[model samples]
Target: MLPQDLITEILLRLPVKSLLRFKCVSKQWLSLISDTHFRHHHRHASSGVILCRRTDIIHHVSLAGSNSDYQPFTSLCFIDDSAGVKILQSSHGLLLCCSNYKLGKARSYYICNPSTKKYSILPEPDYVSVSDNSSVYLVFNPTKSLHYRVACVRMCSSSFNSYQVEIYSSETRDWRSSGSPFAAPFDMVFDSGVLWNAAIHRISPTGASLCFDINQERLGAMPGLPSNEKWSRRRLRYFGESGGRLHLIEIYGCSTQFQVFEMDMDYSSWVPRYNVDIAPVVDTFPEMLRNCIVRNDFVLYAFSLLCLQEDEDDSLLLLHIPGQFVSYSLRNRTFKVLNSISTESNNAFQIGCFHAYQFMETLADADQYL
Candidate 1:
């Protein structure tokens, strides 16, 4: 038998694909991978960079790790049409994804570890019906036994103008309805298995926008926008976590000036953090970016625009919004652009339903590593 440290050392070096397959190697290994300590270690070793796709093929990009040269790490392909998935959110080493197509009444949400290839199809949501229009969020809670939870909010725009919330637990394979009712005003986004809890940008007597918390499976008020600032409901684009804080990125319409703010833990306040300028990118590409941001603890992967360059026909340049993916040190108010990223690929890759983890070399860094 391998020594515990030896086994861990070997396991840390293995890619996520191999690790997932090896979960059945032995109960000890299974327990190790499931353990919080090991998970933290795995999350750190995988940080600072990410694997992305430009066209149909998947390739690796350096986001914050040792490979600053922008080297291609791997090439991946789907087995068939059904194999293509769109990543909605990533947490730990696992990814939350759903099939790209809108198949009538077909449940598509799945939790998978792309590195290990271990996937669990979430039990068919109880509240999703052919007639009811509802939105869903998927959450992974470490404090709650590492089980996956799904929350769905449905709006009844009829006479009552009411909404309902329900949660599904993977461990129990059951769905339970929450006691409270909410009013659906705007759409919601989930991070690491909790609703992002957005501020109510618009207010109407009959309807109001609200934020939903995935972990608690409850509804709460969204924190207000920055005070004494000219703001519009549309300019306020809610981004997931960045730099260990719940973040929001607001742009001034194709203009270079933009703002980044962090949401307080109480879900009641907003603190202005940084102002960004994307004017430099306009010279390279004529059009603005249509990108989504996702995070794993301290690092945020800003999925920006995909452009076809004049010289490179088959290749595309991924324009990442700066400051979206950086390391934040609150004590010093200093942030660092991750060094373990690939600069060779002028364009970043699109994250279609993919997952990435931090590459950790030690223990202290692993705390909240995901």
Candidate 2:
């Protein structure tokens, strides 16, 4: 028989799909794979991106190499048949989803691991009213703890400028209000909340960006890009966390050239990290260029930034063109097609818009929380 350490070393090198099947091989094998430490190490071995379509279908695209494949995964149909499920957020390996709002039925929220097909329906929050608009963000870091947390930000019923935050901890298996109601702009949107630096960071084009510290339970202002009259009419191209850093991408008008900013650790300012120009890509793939005349000025809406991968030698920017997924290297000004979309999905992608979530495969058990 192989030594225990040798067995674990071999198992850690295997992909998640094979490791999941090996879990049923023997009692001892199952114990080793289910170990928290082993699961944590295995999660870092592979990573991918989950693309959520407007119709609620999910497509998984691996990021393990420069050229990866895309496969149709699931629509989360098993959670609830009567209710339509939509993925709201993705933190680490877990996903935060909610049901469509029906006239008579209350909305249902769920945290699920699509890899393991394990899910838990969250209990209804106490502070939310029917009239209030609420957005829930997931905060889970297996490195910090095995437990996860869900933070809900809702507008106060009494004041338009006041917002309240509530947190649900899997360890406690219950919900609790975090801090007191705080003041924010009435038009601030919480839909783009990204978990980083132990807080949920949300950006707004018209107003000041905000961040809510999960540990301290306090709301504070997040630094925004430097002012520029040319970029006044801000179009948020991308705002997400990648490679353990918060990144923001905003475009002024119809230009393909832009700068990608990375937030400093102190949360004081944004540093210009990468300069991106997709004109070459548009020239190569003419189908991506969509030109329209607005007020006698030509406006071009060509591509969307799906994700930014930060690596020591091979930093990449993933993009969604008309009918394909492309990876553009930041270090070297070159691009390659990762995968292609079907005819039906290409048409849908053009009309409906782009929604992407980073997916990290893990063996973290969700049964304990349930």
Candidate 3:
């Protein structure tokens, strides 16, 4: 048998996706991979895959490892129709999804660790009466804490004295409502915010600049958008995080030109990283995108920059391209189209809204916490 030190040294180099599968190789291997130290090493050593979902099917592509990562999609669990499975957010390695349960045909929320294929439905949030269907988001950073956190904001103002925020904690396995809220309530759209630091930052066109701190359960304003580029209704905008910093991505409708911006932690200001204008890519796939835009469908929303994977020189552009998802490499400036199905048929293409999240594959023992 190999020495424990040598075994750990070699195992640390293995990609997380492979390590997850290797857990079944043996009890020893499974225990070692589940070790907290091993998980940290694996998370740091490997850049995990980017997960994008096309309705019921969730497609994942590696950030660095192999070029043949165009793997097929994995179908998530939904009670009746696959259409009921909706991914609210992905953090660490777990996906916070809501599905229509067959028990009572009621909407259920679950935290699923895609790596281990383990999931558990959460009990209803604390007795704080959630009347309106509030938009919810997941916050899970394994490096910070073992438990995951979720918060929901009622997009429309409530009749109550203040806009209440509901929170769920995996540690306690219960939900609670915030007692105090900023006088001004949030009114941003769902999927327009990102979890960064200990707070959730939201971008609004009305210049609300809202942020909800999970730890403190307080809402406040932050730095606004850049003064140069004005917000436009035609452009598609999204907020993301990379390297512990917040990012803003704006893609012009049906255009190959996309702009990226990075924000400071304190929400002080915004800085432009690079104006990615893939003229050749557009020139090549002109008809495809043009037809998509002409459809005037909501699924054709702009391609948002999910995560800027860690690469010394080259940057990976993980975009949420409608119908089909593609990755752009800054080094070669080339577009590699990704598909969810393995079959080589153009008819497999379908038009729908899909979310591409910056995912990191980790075996962080979801069942232990949930």
Candidate 4:
């Protein structure tokens, strides 16, 4: 047998399932498996998938790549049936689920490692307001640090004078004020901010703008959208992060196309990344999808995944269709249907609940943060 030190090294690099099984080899192994240091090492070994809840079931798919064979994937969700909002965000392999139930009368959030089925419910924040739109974001990366923090941002648009920032620290096991940094307003309805380069980039009600830095625990402004661009409400515009860079995606124009831009590391400029024409793409795919484009009234929602290292042609765009996920290649110009995602019913409301977020798998436990 290898020496215990050597075995520990090997175990740390093993897959989650194997590590969990190795716990049964002996009490010593079990203790090592549960050690904080071991979990940290294991987190570095595995990168997680985006978890999407389909009604009661959770489906986790690779952040990039097409489901050419229609292989199915499903993970059990421990969420209470009464839960609402169903917003899923990930940081350091842990998923932060912010939900509003009881008809906006109450708010509850959960942090869980879906791989291990270990979860912890967070105490309600002090600023739980009558407005259901309280802003929250997660900041945790095992590679960079062991600690995790959640930030809730509120803007006093009445004046560009200041914004309220509250932070929840795992070490403190409670939420505290990080103080007002700047005056900014985020249109939660249109802007789904993403954490990149240690800051939460949000936008104004007008469309592509940036604000909030959870790590800095303050609000701030960002450069304006690319010069001479018309941000029409007729089109759907959203922001996403992939491969360590932030992206702005605009889907509009009479051509029914998608315009994607990648932000520079310095956050000072934008570069055209991909220009996808959906009409030709629909002609190349299934009848149902083709009809979505031909009918002219069908709505499209997409979840962006990083450009996969293996697929050179393009970044993967996961189309949010009822009861299924369709992967569209930005470069190679291909489309594949994801059959692994199965819905219990075809109800439009239930289908609308299916939202996807990129999850980076890590061994970080929610308990350690507290």
lDDT of 1 by residue, 43-63 (tens): 333333344443233344433
List model 2 lDDT by residue over 118-208, tens digit each: 7888877665542327878888888888898888888877887788888888998878889899887656778767888879887665747
Per residue, candidate 4 scores C-alpha lDDT tens digits across 1-370 of: 7798998888876766677788899999999988887876774323424445442455555534433332122443565536553645766567777564676456667777766766677776675441344567778777667888887665554566455667788877888777564544444431266788778777665754655666665555667666454554344355667667687765543444766788877667778777766565445444435334322544543332322321233467666443445666777666776555334423422433545566555566776566
Please state every model's RMSD to the true fold in angstroms.
10.0, 2.5, 4.5, 4.7
**Per-residue accuracy of model 3 over 5-122 as CA lDDT, tens digit each:** 9999888776656777888999999999888777765663434453544444555566554544533236564333443666777787777777644554566666777666677776
TM-score (all chains, Cα) for each model = 0.61, 0.91, 0.79, 0.77
Off by over 4 Å in 2: 54-56, 63-72, 126-132, 230-232, 290-298
Q: What is the lDDT of candidate 1?
A: 0.46
lDDT of each: 0.46, 0.75, 0.63, 0.60
Report the number of the highest-lDDT candidate: 2
Segments in model 1 whose C-alpha atoms lie over 4 Å from true places: 1-3, 6-10, 17-41, 48-60, 65-84, 102-107, 126-132, 157-161, 186-209, 214-217, 227-234, 253-255, 277-370
The per-residue C-alpha lDDT of model 1 at residue 108 equals 60
CA lDDT of 283 in candidate 1? Answer: 38
